[model samples]
Target: MKRTLVIGDIHGGLKALIQVLERAKVTTDDTLIFLGDYIDGWSESAQTIQYLIELSEKQECIFIKGNHDVWCEDYLRIGKANRTWLFHGGALTFEGYQQLSDEEKKKHLNFFERMKLYYVDDNNNLFIHAGYTSMKGPEQEFYKSNYNWDRTLWEMVLTMDKRVKKHSVLYPKRLKIYNEIYIGHTPTLYYNIETPMNAINVWNIDTGAAFTGKLTVLDVNTKQYWQSDNVNELYPNEKGRN
Candidate 1:
């Protein structure tokens, strides 16, 4: 069986991310999947994008668009939008951008636009930035428009009757898209949590690394999780940054 490493939200902690990857000992043959939130929160947003772009070029790395990344793209396109961008850990992303040269800023913005909303491998493992949508029927039909910046769909998935939420109600008939689905966005107390219904099937890898929690990575096949010990201590005063 091929080994797949699914990573949770990096939140611009490049130091912690590099350490996690090094610890995982990722190689060219292994598939490394990132469940978005690549930028925003700590610092080094631009550098994080550059590093992911470089890694994508060299190895089998798949990226999904996280909500924060959507905010970054919007800020780059229109300079501003909702206050959620500033409130939900976007100020650090702005700080990272300010540290970059004009050319680098342009490069990272372009890269962000090209990120995929979801990645589904041949093995059936689904990787999404946030939670999966609650829309049903055909996969392509739902993913085409619903996957991009659809907060309503994400909310439904997160709060839907906890019992059915584990399995993709968005497309009930086709729930077996993969052996399991890996996601971020919702931080869990544990580095990884298996759905009560599915045992070790559905995995939530976000351990609130940007807040008072740890960053997480999981080996899907083995169900082994790796986590950072500390949060970004220098995240800056949230109120002041906003």
Candidate 2:
């Protein structure tokens, strides 16, 4: 059977990304679902996106829009650059982007523009870059902006009891929306773990590649995961998101 490989935040760590992909043994027959934040930490942000674009031609790829990606889109669209975004490793992305040709810049822009806020596959598996706020499924008419910005969704899951009855009552609508939900953005390192974590059916896969953690790729169906060495080690001389 074909597999679906869901990856975590890349944060411009091209080496880590490549390592995880090879470790996972991803193939053209498999579907690669990226939770986003592809750029903005390591120095190879543009190169990372370029690699993904090339990968898409060989396999099925689903790219989700991350908060950092939103910052990237804003800059590409209006030439607007946010200082806060810059401070959060966006400068690295800007630097890498400058080395791209005009055609390459357009390709990157198009890739960012086409990313989705959230995706619910036929199996009711939800893939999103950040926590979502609404409980009325992905179609609810809420602030669409929160799709890539909210934290309450995962926060609630993290704080709630993993027991079924208790969680069902507290997050009844949320749990009813999908069989499983996978997200990036909030790194697992915040919880002191450097691997994908599960809580109340939600999987937090951002292993803090932008920090000192690793880049992770998980098989959504089998729950088997693979990771690169600590992201910090991959770039011995360069500072990550700091």
Best by lDDT: 2
The TM-score values for the models, in the order shown, are 0.77, 0.95
Name the runs in model 2 displaced over 4 angstroms: 166-171
Q: All candidates: CA RMSD in angstroms?
A: 4.7, 1.5
Give one digit per residue, the lDDT tens place, for model 1 in 1-242.
45788888888877778877777777788788888888777766778888988988888888888878888988877666458887777776777677778777777888888888887778777777554454342255555444434434334334545465435544343344456666677666443532211223456677676665667778877777676655555444442122
After the best TM-score superposition of candidate 2, give how far the Cα of residue 132 lies from its true spot, in angstroms.
1.7
**What is the alpha-carbon lDDT of model 2 when measured against the actual structure?**
0.88
What lDDT does candidate 2 reach at residue 104? 81
Q: Indicate the worst ten consecutive residues by lDDT in candidate 1.
A: 191-200
> How close to the true structure is residue 215 of candidate 2, measured as C-alpha lDDT?
97
lDDT of 2 at 229: 99
Measured by TM-score, the strongest candidate is 2
